[model samples]
Target: MNEFSDKLLQWFDHSGRHDLPWQQQQTPYRVWVSEIMLQQTQVKTVIPYYQRFMERFPDLATLAQAEQEDVLAHWSGLGYYARGRNLHKAAQIIQQQHHGVFPTEFDEVVALPGIGRSTAGAILSMALKQRFVILDGNVKRVLSRFLAVAGWPGNKRIENHLWQVAEDFTPHERFDDYTQAIMDLGATLCTRSKPNCQACPVQANCMAFKLNRVKEFPFSKPKKVKPIKQAKLLMLINNQQQVWLEQRPQKGIWGGLWSLPQFETDEALVAALNPSVKTHSEAVSSLVKWKAFRHTFSHYHLDIEPVKLVQEAPADWQGQWHTFTQAESLGLPAPVKLLLSQLESEYVKNG
Candidate 1:
């Protein structure tokens, strides 16, 4: 092992996070689940979800056998619906192709639905004690600053260079601890903003720190204005206090998740519900336009316009009507959940 790795490992033995839920058992299945959950999400946020997920589906077989809705329901508020969908799909593949065992081969692991190169490495190194290099977000920050790498790590040219650095620093022995140590360093000490350089183990040789430009090494993504997309959420209600919900298509945003019917405009919604607008206008009881809000995504901004329609006659809607309690338990987009909750609260307050 090199001096850099040695120092980091020593510090890790003393201060690194060793008691995370997944670390307790440290199986391939556990590590796989944890890695997926940690993608684009913080450790604190992933813990409760991870624990609840593990409790519900503790092993590969259980997860593989679970319904997609059940899996998504557990991951409802976690966001990034595709990850949950992929996790479930990957589990089924493992059951069918590998006899319900989490694959250990590097290529085989990476072939799974949600498992990427870095995630595959993490599952193997941390769970199987294999020597594999991982360059996750945290690792990228730690390495970019340590080596003073230029250009955003997302760029292919820069990413390849960072991958080499990660491979070089990785040790053959105690690969498990080394893998966890480096990630912990980035997450705890080498944070993106307000890093604790004094407590950093390798800060003495850190080029960015020496140059007093820790924030400049790992260049941020080139700024671009996120496009704004507008949509209307139709909350059709019946007398029994049930609301209309549709299962989103199996691909694209909020894939395979239950959500309110989305329409491009009020006219389009009216055309679908009532072909003759004049007759429909006379029969409708109450139509409410709630306050609009923005849900920002990585590539665009979603301007959500929620409309609550309390109609007496149950029109032949494309989706089914579910009670507020039933809808609460399904896999709903964060915005949809919030709107439903607000509507439900208002309904109870007046009565």
Candidate 2:
């Protein structure tokens, strides 16, 4: 092993995390699920979710056989719904194409949906003890600071350079431990903000640390103004306290989840309810507009105006009516869950 690997391993022998849930069993399916869930999410937040998911779908065959709604329900409140959708799709593909076995070949693993180059490498190295290089966000941050890589890691050229650097640092033996060690170092010591440079094993060799510019190395992405969009969410309720819900189209935000009916404007919402009322004016006057809130996405901010309509839904309505308890069991977006909880609390306090 080189100096980098040697020191990192030495530090990892005592300080690295050894008891992560995924680290215990060390199966390809477990590692793949953990890797996918870890993307853009923190370790602490992922632990309970990971444990719950594993308990529900313990093996490749089990996950492959699960329904999309079931898979998505288990993934509720874990933002980035596309990850859950892609994971389910990939499992079904593996069941049919690979006969319910996790592929060992790098090409086949990376070809799976939501399994990018770094994720594939991580799964292979950690679970299969293969000598594959990983360039995940944590690895990228560590390498960027160590080598003082100049550009944002998102840039194609910068990413290629980091990949080459990662390839060079990968040790021939103890590939699994080495992979975990490097990731631990980044997650624990070399964090995005307020990095603990003193405890770092390779601090002496880190160019950014030596130059007192550690935070400057992994440059931030170019900023662009996120556009704000507006929507009116209609929470139509019946005398029985059942709320109307519809499944979102399977290709957009909150895809495949049950959600309140949304309209671009109040007029559009009124029009939808007009058929049940004597006049459009009567429907508009009946809407009780509650507090509006903002839910921000990566590319835009959605300003939501929740309007309550406490009338029985028309029999011809496209969606079904469900009590709050039933809705909680279905896959729901974070905001929808919050609104349901609020409504439940209000009903309890008032009654």
Name the 10 consecutive residues with the lowest summed lDDT in model 1: 278-287
Q: Write the per-residue lDDT of candidate 2 for residues 218-323, one digit (tens) a residue.
A: 9999888999999998888888989999999999999999999999988788877765454577667768888999999999999998888888766677788999
TM-score of 1: 0.96
lDDT of each: 0.90, 0.91
Q: How much is 228 displaced in model 1, in angstroms?
A: 0.4
- Model 1's C-alpha root-mean-square deviation from the true structure amounts to 1.8
Native-vs-model 2 lDDT?
0.91
For model 1, residues 291-323, the per-residue Cα lDDT tens digits are: 889998878999988988876333655578899
Worst 10 residues of 2 by lDDT: 274-283
Best prediction by lDDT? 2
